[model samples]
Target: MLIHGVALMALAVAALLAAFSSIQKAGWLAAASVAPVLAVAGVLAAWAAAIHLTGGEKFDDHPWV
Candidate 1:
């Protein structure tokens, strides 16, 4: 998870740099847009991992019989 965060941050920085160099507004917008999604995905992954490590289940088990 830490590695993923670091990678995402690095990519975000790279994207920012690329955005700065590009002439098209869409290029800058496209580069800026991916960072937040990556960040959010990383956070959600860590959260889900923590829950799994703590023995929490994503769904409740109910006996039907």
Candidate 2:
């Protein structure tokens, strides 16, 4: 899960750079190809992760500890 979240963030950063490049060199349509959906997903992922990490601690079940 940790790796997956990091990978997703990397992908989001790459997509954002690509979109900005396309918008500078090409047009809006090209810029819209990947970033919009990925951006939305990235925001949702961050929100969920924030909730999970912060709100989750209160409900944690530590069997091993």
Candidate 3:
């Protein structure tokens, strides 16, 4: 999940840069499409980190066992 979050953020940044650099409709569309995806990924990443850090719950009983 962390990896995904980082990847999505990178994609969003790239798309944003492209959108700003290009005045084409497709560039704007690509940026628009990725905006929400990035937002959701960011939220999930933060939520997961919060839960993990707070010791909310664990999916595995003994991860190494």
Q: List TM-score per model, in order.
A: 0.41, 0.47, 0.43
lDDT for 59 in candidate 2 is: 46
Alpha carbon lDDT of each predicted model: 0.55, 0.61, 0.56
- For candidate 2, write residues 1-65 as lDDT tens digits: 55655665565566556656667777777767665775666566665555454433454678887
Rank order by TM-score, top first?
2, 3, 1
For residue 39, give model 2's deviation from the true position in Å. Answer: 5.2
Clash pairs for candidate 3 = none
Measured with C-alpha atoms, the lDDT of residue 61 in candidate 3 is: 69
Model 3, span 1-65: residue lDDT tens: 55555555565566555545543545666667665565555566556555545655657668677
TM-score between candidate 3 and the true structure = 0.43
Which run of 10 residues does model 1 get worst, by summed lDDT? 16-25
Provide the global lDDT of candidate 3 against the true structure.
0.56
Judge candidate 3 at residue 31 and give its lDDT. 60
Tens digits of per-residue lDDT for model 1, 44-64: 555655554555556667878
RMSD, model 1, all Cα superposed? Answer: 7.1
Scored by Cα lDDT, where does model 1 land?
0.55
lDDT ranking, high to low? 2, 3, 1
